[model samples]
Each structure stands twice: as C-alpha cells, then as structure tokens.
Target chain A: MPTQRDGTPVSVLARQLRILDTFDAGTVFLSLSEIAERSGLPMTTTHRLVAELVEERMLERLPDRSYQLGLRLWELAARTPRAMGLREIAAPMVQFVQGQVRQHTQLGVEGGYDVVYLDRASAPNAVVNATIVGGRISLGASAIGHVLLSDKPRAFLAKIVEAGIRRYTDKTPQTLDELVDVVDRVRELGYSVADGFIHPAARGMAAPIYGPDGRVLAGLGMVVPSGEPVNMRIVELLRSAARRVSQQMRAAYIDPDHPHALPGAKFRVLINSSKSSMEYFEGNEGG
Target chain B: MPTQRDGTPVSVLARQLRILDTFDAGTVFLSLSEIAERSGLPMTTTHRLVAELVEERMLERLPDRSYQLGLRLWELAARTPRAMGLREIAAPMVQFVQGQVRQHTQLGVEGGYDVVYLDRASAPNAVVNATIVGGRISLGASAIGHVLLSDKPRAFLAKIVEAGIRRYTDKTPQTLDELVDVVDRVRELGYSVADGFIHPAARGMAAPIYGPDGRVLAGLGMVVPSGEPVNMRIVELLRSAARRVSQQMRAAYIDPDHPHALPGAKFRVLINSSKSSMEYFEGNEGG
Candidate 1:
C-alpha cells in the first residue's frame, strides 16, 4: 500500500516487504521460487526485488541461491534502544535467575496480540520450550503474554478477545470469560501462570517489568517442566526479580546527550541493587 | 554507486546504506545530524532517507526521537541462512563450554577486513570484553579476528597492513611483521591466542571451525582472565572443541529440506553446537 512520488502505487516495495515478512519463527529461509509463491508475485518480479535487496545488503544470498536476512538488518536492529537497552539491563538478572533455577528465563515485550521474546537464557538440562529469541506467541497462551495483556486497557482486551484466541494446546484459555478471569488473577497476584498452554509439557510464571513512568514495558518469565505444579515459592521469586529489574530500568533512562553510556556499569548497578533488594525484601515480606 | 534504468546517477541507495554502515561496534546508535556527518551526506538527504527507513521499520524512533535499529531488521537478519545455520548448530555446544569455562564464548565470521560476531555468551562475572552480538572487530587485533584472518588471501592481509592497523593496547601487534607471524602461527596450529591485545586484562584463544567441505567457515573462541596464561592445554581444548562442533555441523547440513534449515535453525545450530561441543570436550579434555 505504498505510493511513489508520482502518486502511482509502489507495489514493488510492498512485494519486497511481503517477501521479507514471509520469514518468521516457522520460516527462516526460502528458495527464490518459494519466495515468489509466498509473496504471490511473479517470478521475475521476485527475482528482481531479491537481487536489489541483496545488492543493498538488506538480504544475503547463500551459496545455494536461497535468501536469508542480512547483517545490515542485525546491525540496524542493534540500534533500537528499547530492545537493546532493556535487554542489556535485564540479561544479567535473567542469567542470575536461570543460574539458580537451572531453567529457561526470558524477557519479552508485547507486540500486538502476542509477546515477542527479546532475550532468553537456558541451562543445558532445562526443559525444552519452543520459544526462541525473536519468536512470538499469542497473548492468551503464554505467561508473559498474559502478564502484558493484564496491564492493557479493558477496551483493548475486549478487542483482542473479539478477534478470537488461538488454542495452541488444550490448556489454552479460549473463551472471553476465561481470559477475563485469568487477567483478573494476574493483576491481583502481581504475576501470571500458564500451564501447558503453549507447549503440552511446559509451564511458565511471569511478572511485568515497568519503565520510568511505571508503565508495563516488558514481561519477565521462567519456563519449567509441566509435571511440577505451580507454587507460591516460584511466583514470589519471579515477582521479586521483576520488581528489582524494573527499578533498575527506571534509574538508567539513557540521557540524550550521553548516548554512549557504559552498558556494563548499568548492568552491574542493576544486578547489585537487585540482589540487595531481594535479600532485604525476602527478610521483610517473607512471601 | 548505483544507477537507475534510465542511466540516471543514483547514489541515493548507496548513501543510505553508508548511513547504516556508520553503526558498528564503536557506534551502535546515533543522532540525526551525527548520521549526516558520518555518512558524508547532506542533512536534508539524510533526514529524508532516515524518515523513509523509519517508516519502513528499518529504524526505530526512541522516546526522545533519537533513532535505534528496529526489530524488523533483526527479524530480517535472523534469516541469513549461512550465519544463522552455523550458529544454530554451534550454540548448544557454545553454551556447554561457557558453563564449564565460566567465561566468554563467541562465534564469528570473516567480513571484509573484520570479523563479525554472530553470537556470544558471557558469564556475569566474566571479564568485560568490548564485543556484542552483531558487533565487529579488526581481523588483525583479537584472537578470533586472527583465526578468521588466517583464512583470507595473502593480498588481503597485505592490504590491511598497508592501510595501517590501529593499536588498541600496548600488547597489540603494531608491526606488519608481527601480525604476519601471528597469522602464520594460527594457520599452522589451527588456532590463535592473544593476551592483552584488544583488552589489557583478558586472554583469548580461538579455533577455526570447518564446514563439510573443510572450508574455514567460522571461528569459535573463549576469553578468560589474562592472569591465567593460555598454555598449550587451553589451546588443545579450544581446537578439539571446535573440531567436534564442526562434525555436528556437517551432520546437520545433510538435511537441507528441513523447514527450520533457514536462518533461524542455522543460527541456533551454530550457537547450540558450539556451546555443547565445548562442554562435551571441556570435561573430557581436562583443561
């Protein structure tokens, strides 16, 4: 739906973008004909566009003539302050939590109707979870997704429900009423629990991470074996970690003038303060 | 420079790409005017191009209107089959090695006169190495860089020497003769080691990984404390680990028809195999 300077429809740009979008968690690379078929463009058009993109280094052509995303894209994405900044601060804390639990720990942000994982860490023996960095899952089927959904406006939630929920597994809550009850529980308990929803053998616990204005900017979660029942102990640990991470995020608000802030210093401050806060709160709250 | 079909001189695309290239390990994010200055383009042209890129989701506008890379780019880069495929097979192995070494583990590919890091994992207590995922380093500087450079032609190495190398620290090899000798050593030993070259307090050892055809595909490395010398014992561990990871990569390559065989799977395989191979070999090798 793009237009050129002469007011003509720039279908080429749209087709090129469509070809790029055809790649996701499920489809990461494609043959030239596969791209042509997926984008519904003529073979010639797809070839030309793919060639132009490759020339610009926006896409890379392998030895097999198939196309994959280019380093240019990765270099560009590294500039996104939200993904880079948030992940930089949250990674050490996530690593610490993963070290203790010896499970999968992830940091995600709500994107439309799903939660997109930005960073993830896992121990070698950790339970298998289908989620990967840059992978997305439905809001109604993931603990991080539910935590994000619980923080949104009621009108938004209503629209999401009306759009229909996907049943990834039998544990996925399908009805609007069920989703509402789950959201309410998440708000009251300060966390969300998903049991075998996205994956049949995985359960997840998640809490919301806030930015400077206390807006629910991202969600932090842990994936464990489904055979282990969800317990208050795990929930409390997640909440405490989320709170500490959020507080650190609030402190390091990337001043415009100081664009080159020391990322390591920021991470150290977050981890140190978070550890101290966890100890102090553990003794005081006894949750 | 790029030309249009009508023979019109169109450096617009090239100029726009230069703006993107300005972002490297040293500069991840930049202000509007800074981009213009670095790209050597007029402010008006830079502004318009940046706007178009932002609209296309190639760049993201921060809360303060400063620009960073976008997730769209990350998603696109995630599709690069060659880099992603190798990383996918190697990540598990890399993670296992990281767990045992409790240091930094990285996977890199040769790019022009530099080595581009595809994936990296570091312990919270690990020595701070000025490298990030998607970042690049000079081929003649670090251990990984040297390993990657060992695969390059002699003319390329001479060109780099003639261009003059920037000395990062006192320990960095400044003379062309010294650099040539080090690269020769790397090719002979099948690995490279650098103490206090890039960073004064870190010692890094890297081994080149080969593909099914025995072509040097990527380099896997470990960065440990400099106080602990990188003796023959450490070098053997890295070489053996790289060899095992290369074997796993060969096994994964036979199935090109696999859906995830694209960028995502490729990346995961490289990272996973590298991590796992390191762990498997580390225990048996007794470093």
Candidate 2:
C-alpha cells in the first residue's frame, strides 16, 4: 500500500522490492500468500513479481514450495569491496577474542539507527548473542551500538531520539538523554558496557575499531554471562585487540590512489593516547 | 541478451538483475553507459532502472556518481538461513585449520557447477587462494569443488560437464572424464587433493562436511604451498576439522519436521572410518 507522488501507485520496482523486504530473520521461508500479506501487495502482482524474482534467482523456491533468499544474492554481497576489507582484516582479531574470552565476540558497523554485525566468532558454550552476522540491533540496546553511534553527527543522534525507544530489558536506554549520556561516555572512555540490556543474564562490552583513515569503521565486542561484575580486564583486552586490528586495517589500506598520506599516520595519535590508558590499567591491576 | 521462451523481451525484473550481474569482483563500479553496455539494455531503460535501484538501496550511487552494490543487499543476504548456519557453525573449525596449518582455510558448497565459498580464514603468509567467500570456482579446478560434487546426482554432474571447462593451470582437469575420476577418488578416499590445479605453486585439500540430515552439505578445505609434497599431517588436520564441523552442524540442526532420519548418521560412518585413518597416520608419523 505504499503510494507514490501524485497519489499514484508505487512504481513496479518499488512493488517488487516490497516483496523482498517481507522476508526477514524469522520469516526465512514463506508461502506465496504469506509474502503477499507481508508485502501488502495484491496476490496477482505478488505472484507475477515473485515468478520474475525466482527466474532471476533473487529468491529460491524451497523443497516445500516456499521461498527463501537465493545464493545468487549472497554471492553479489560477498564481493562488496568495503565489506571485504573491513571483515577480512577484523576476523582474526575477533577469533582471538573468542578464543581467549570463551564468549561471543562480534564486529559491527553503524547502519542507520542500528548496529549491523559484520562478523562474529562464538565460543562453544557462549551466552546467547541476539546479534548475528548481517543482523542488526537498535543503538540503545547493544554495547556495539553505543560504540558505532558515538562518533555520528548530533542531528543524526537527535533524529533517532525522536523516533521513541522500544525497551528490551530494564537496563536498556529508554530516553534521548539517557542514550546520549551513554554515547558521550563511550566517546570519552573509548569503549561501552551494557549489562542485561537485551537478555537479563547477558553482559555485552564493545570498543571502537578504526579503519586505515582513523575513522570509526566498526565496533568489536563480546557478550558474556552476567553472573559476576563486568570484567575490566576483558575490556582492556578488547581495546588492545581493536587497536591491533585498526593497525592492520591501516596497513592493508595504503591506497595507491592516495600515495602521500599513510592510512596509519592519523591513527598514531589515538594509539599514543591509548597507551596511557593501558599504563593506567596496568597500575590498577589489583582493583 | 536473454529473451523469453516466446522470443519476447524478458521481464523488467530480469533486466534489472542483468545490471547487478554486470558488477562482479572485477567490475564493482561502473558508469551508467557501462551498465547499459554490459546489460545490453537501452540507455534510458538502464538509467531509469538504476535510479529506482538506487532509491531502493539495492544499488548505491558512488561519490563519483558510479554505481556499486548497496549495503541493503548485504543485509538481506546476511539473513539467508542456509548461509547463516554454514558460516556461523563452520567458522570456528576454519579458524582452527588456519592456526594449525598456517594456511588459507575455506568452506564452500556446490552452486550449480561451481563451488561457492561460504567463509574463509587465511594465514598472512599462506599460499594464494583465488576463490574467496561468495566467489565461485569450477569443479575441475579446486579440491573443495571435488568434495562438494561427489554426492550430487549424475544429471547435475552431467549438466556441469556439458557447460564446458575453463582451465586455469596444467594440473586442472580438462575433460569431463578426468573430472569424474577425481570426484570418484575423493568419494572413495574420503578427501580430495588438487595440487597446483588452480595455481602452479598451491596445493589444495578438502573433505566433505555433512549437514544434520547426513547429506553432503559443504566442503571444508585449505590451500598450502606445493613445496616438499602435500603433507599428510595437514590433510589429517583438515579432515578432523571437517569432521568436527559436521558434528556441530548435526548438533544444531534438529528440526521435528525431519523426524525418523537421525541427523549425521551417515556422516557418523565416515567419522568412524576416519578414526582408522587417524590411527594409520599416527603409525606412519616416522615416515
């Protein structure tokens, strides 16, 4: 029922995309009727468009005659250059964190008002992590979300604030001021901690991971059991891991297009400052 | 120029997909005219479709006004259930292979005639692996490809053979009969070895990983240097890792709809036999 300008029906392409948008994490397999209902398009149009989509391999007909997103679409997304560089470089760091912490370690980036996880490495007995690779979580409900949103524009922050929050747990930020306060602290401390913000017995922590350009490329973090206080040692470990990944990102991104400016040069300032925090943490080891 | 069976023009959906198909790993960004040329569509139609695609976030306009695959496509692809289970469940096993072998470890599945890599973990100094995640490799040119195609139907195999071969190196199988022999060997030996098939100095090895249904789900593999012969120890490592991944895939895939068929039961037969191979290796370690 999405209308176009001048009160006309939406374009054919728009109508088609609506069908694709209907299939989500939960509704991976859907019948033709279900797709029509979710898309809010008529059955005739839905059937025609879906037939075309299947022909294009954008959607695959399942064994039970339902539909799921096709491997062709996944193949196309797999070749995206920006995602390739960030994910390939950050994967080992996330793997290391998963090994050492024995928890659910994830890497994510800002995607509008949510944190879109790019990659995750989970331990065998890890706590439930609501965010999966390619999945998103609201900025107010995730530690990674806080890390991703910390460096965004004030207007962008204001816009999401006006949208109203949907609280998942008692610890989730429920107001604009509360959300901004956490992001401000994340900026100041260069990390975020959210205890039971999504699941009541899970604690999540995150730190900003920068690209070669020293921009906040993604958030690297882990989810742990909330039986004890959040571990400061793990937070330090996460930051150090993020720092190493950022360095590797910088090293790999020396674009021949911009030969004079080294990607790692700008990040040195942050690294130097982080060393002071490392020293401070070392001094307070017993705390 | 794809046409309908009646010799009429294909649908608008097919035309739009042609534009997306034009942008592969080599051609990530293209000018409007380039898109039109590649899609073999009228310039006006290409322009209109690209505009709608940009609006839909299936295709993004670059800063320089060229087009690239949008992040929205990646998000949708990320939620694909089959890829989700395979990548998430198989990642840790791939990571372990990367650590032990100090080489490129990858997971792949048969996509039509080609093997499509699901996920990979690479060592910094590993031999070059041309097939990346979401990228495709011919069944004739990869160890993983052999592992993936071994259990498929004869018609499926015949269709790929009829599609013709594109050789990358001298070691690559050039005839359908040669391809079949290798796949048969892979089936009998419970593993595959393709030395310098894709690249002159690289040795690729693979083993099948089964789904919870005990069907051949994917191929877990690694690429190492072809120096000093293909090491038996690394092959053992790869098979064990694949076996472990198959177990995890089984443990996680218990759907009631699939009752009466014990998940991974057929694969357990492989695992039990593989243990004897492990013992054989342990006995021959001094060799």
Candidate 3:
C-alpha cells in the first residue's frame, strides 16, 4: 500500500486509483476478487470502492458481473490536452506519413519510463507493428523512445541507465554508453533510425515533434519492413511531417490561454542557430 | 453532493469523480478555486483531493498551476471495451465508408440520453460536422441517435421524452410523436436519414451496428451537404458496412473469456426472420 510522507496510509482516492491501475491492455475485465487481489486491498474495502466506482460510472459492471473500465473515463480524457489535443493536431500529419509510406505510422509521448502511443495509422497489410493506440514501449528500446528522451537532462539519462534497459533484439542498445550515443545522435540529426531494434522483421525511424515551448513534446515515426536498405526518403518525410506538426503546436501555444497548451516545467523554447538541429532541418527542408 | 440510498453522503471516490466531471471540452483547464467552485466542495476538501489527484496523475498540474485531465485517465480508458474495443473493431468499416463517401463517417454508442461518438473518419474537405470522438449528441436530434435508441425499452424512451429534446433546427423532432416516428422509421428501414436536423447545411444518415449479443450496439453514419437529394447508394453502403461490423462483433463475443465483450443488462441475442431488420439488411446485401 502507498503511504504519505508522514507514514500515514493513503486516502480512499489513492486506493480507488490503484484499482483503476490494475486494468491494462491484457487485463481488461476483472471480477471483484480479481480487483481485490491485484489492488492489494482488503475484500471489503475493495467491494466498497468498487461499488462507489460503478455508481460513478468509472467502472462498468458487465453481464457476468465482471468489471471493466467505463466510458466516463474516456469522456473525461477527451478533455486532456496532453493526449487528445496532441493527437487531434498531429493526426493529419501522421495520416499523411502513413498514406505516403503505406506502413504503420504513429505519434507517441513520453510517459514515465515508457513511450505511450497517442495515435497510429496502419495500412491493411502493413509490416508487423506491435504498438497500438494508448499502448507503451520501453523508452530505451525504440526509435521513438530515443527521440522523446533526446532532450532530457544528463541526470535523468543516468537514472534511466541505472534502471537498465531490456534486451528486445541484438540491435537494441544494452549499455549506458550505447544508449547515450543513440540519444546524442538523435539530438544531432533531428531524427532516429533503429534497425531491427524492437524486432528483426521491422525497422523504425522517428523525429521529434516540438511544442510551442520548443521542447520535444512527442515523437512521430513509421515502422517499415526490414531486409531492405534504409530509406532516407522516408526519414525526410518524417522530419518534414514532424516540422509541420511542431509549427502547429507553436501556433496553438502562442495563445497561452488556449486549452490545448500542455503544461510541463521542462518545456523550453528552441533557439534557432547553425548548431541547432531543428534549425538545421528547416534549412535542409527549405521551410 | 450526491448521497446514497440511506441518505449517507457519497464516498471520496464520488467526490473525486465530481472533481473530474468539472472538466469538459470547453473547460479543459481548471484552477484549484475553479474546481472547488464547480464541484461544489469545500475549498479545503477540494485542495486535499486535488493534491491527491495530481500525485496520482489523474490530473496533471500545468506550468501555471492549473489542472487538466491527465494521460493516466486516457491510458485507463484505452482498456474500456465500450469505447476503445468497439472502436478498434469498427474502425476499418468506418474508414471504408468515409473513403467511399468522401465525407464525415462515424460510429457512436448510446451513453445515457446521448449518442457518444467513438470513432470518426473525415475527408479534408468534408462537410461541416459538429461531432468529435467522445462528443455527444442528443437521442432526438441526430440520425445516429435515432438508430442507437431504436432498441431501447418504451419506459426509457418515455423518460427521454419527459426530459424534452433540444431543437437545433426546424427539421429536428419537436414532440414525442415525431421522435417515436423517427425511431420506428429507423427500425423499419434498417437505417436512418436525418435531413437538416442538427443544422441547415448538413444532413446525417445512419445504420445500427450490432454487438455479439445481436442487440443494437452502436450506429455508423455519414454527414454530407444537406441540399443534395438523398443518395440511395450511400444508404446501401452504410447498411453493408454496418453488417460487416456486426459480423465481427459476433465473432468477438463467441468466446466468453474475450476481454472486449461489453457488459450491459439490456443486451440480447438478435433473432433472425423475414421481418427482422438485421435479416432484411443481410438479404438485401445478399449476405
């Protein structure tokens, strides 16, 4: 159980949230007992909280009395600028990339130690893509993850390195030095190319999308079939798309009162210079 | 504050939900005072709850110290069978309709007294559509709403009538008789054609999509320019698309252990016959 700074037990709100956290991509439905066990709460407390959650429509009781996450949560999340706002603005660009490449194109934001996908567009028979909307990939194992973490502080990077990276494939970075090298390359090139890092059958390339504050807000990428030469044309397409999305984010955040402006303390305006990668991309793209 | 049947005040979960409910599309950001005011909670209670919420990432604290619904909520909502599950299965059909019609095509399910859109595909220059994914339209006002309400019990329909419908345009249903007529027409025709009901410049048409239980689960629809003559070809395409989606739902629900089967008390196995609307559509489509 979670405790406060004073060593007191957490509030009912914390326990309720613990219940919600139990549901994920694989575990969508759970009986009361399952929720109780997964949440590590007493059965009576779980029952009381579950009753209140159902009454509030945060959780829906199914036909067989199993519980699932409810629509009310989605309804509330729709108003979240971080997820849906970024998605609405970046969707057209993501769609364009998918249309041009006929592969799996996606946008994802940094969520803790994972890269959480916000939107994805896939062709009917596109190359294998394990990612889905609202799904997560480890921040150390994917091209998009490299781009999202490119702007983080050295201390943060060291912390991630200390935690250790999972080995998904032979090409995935397994050491701190290799991970740091990848992050530095992404910062220098304004994009990342991961060849068969997640899976041997696929290659992923991504570029950083900037917010109005000029920080790396998200990563836009495409997953194409491996066994072929890397496509620089696709990399350029992704960079151009990311630039367009970044321009929109700038416009959206110019009005500080605009509800779509995502709030983050680490956000900073990107400076334009010969050395700045964003400026370098704009020069090459003639934008 | 909401109370239980025994007149006891609702749980902290309910109050926390009340805080969440204060957010909407227009009211995405809320200051501590604003949340307290909107949620009708004491300032101290609101502060404590807000602190806990931000700590849990249920609400994100912005740079300016205002709060917006957080990505955690979206992550949780992504596991909802009613929203994301239905959306994932129905997306391809929705895309097909949108591609064929070059207009706004969408899928929606009944939520309380409204039809909540789950997914939408729109051409770049499609006719104006007021709906967005996770947005709502009243049951008496739109074609999608008509089809979604077609399977509900009479007492529920009467309750909706008692609440009265908002008239968005002169063509919208003005009385209980007109609303009932619209529902009946949707039932008989296996689709709905709503002309200028929501606005003068847009026309919406829809057909019901069924769940594995054979009950009306959602509505798939298109919005196009209002002045053109009703297109029978579009209606036929919509009915066919709905049928395909229903078949997928049937396949999905065949396994009792599947996580995507939505739970609802009113859901029933749809029977087939000459007079059944679903059967009639299948026959017309030669399926």
Best by lDDT: 3
List residue ranges in candidate 3 displaced over 4 A: A4-9, A99-102, A123-128, A250-287, B4-9, B92-96, B99-102, B121-128, B250-287
Worst 10 residues of 1 chain A by lDDT: A264-273
Off by over 4 Å in 2: A1-9, A256-287, B4-9, B31-34, B37-42, B62-66, B153-155, B257-287
Give one digit per residue, the lDDT tens place, for model 3 in A132-195: 5787888888889999889997677777777777776898887778889989998898899888
Q: Grade the docking of candidate 3.
A: acceptable
Better of 1 and 3 by TM-score: 3
Error of 1 at B197 (Å): 3.6
The DockQ-derived docking category for candidate 1 is: incorrect
Q: Candidate 3, clashing residue pairs?
A: none
Can you give the TM-score per candidate against the true fold? Answer: 0.76, 0.84, 0.83
Candidate 2 residues B1-287, lDDT tens each? 36877433477777777778877654566789988887778799889989888887888886777777788888888766667557777777777788887777888987777888888776545565575567788876789988888887666667777786667678788776888888889989999998888768778899899877678888989877776676889888888888998887776544545432222211111111122322332343322
> Per-residue CA lDDT of candidate 1, range B88-195, in tens?
556656666766777788888876677787767666567757566666678888788888788777787887777666686887877778888989999897888888
TM-score of 3: 0.83
| Candidate 1 DockQ, CA atoms | 0.23
* Total backbone clashes of candidate 2, pairs 3 or more residues apart or in separate chains: 0
State each candidate's chain A TM-score: 0.81, 0.81, 0.83
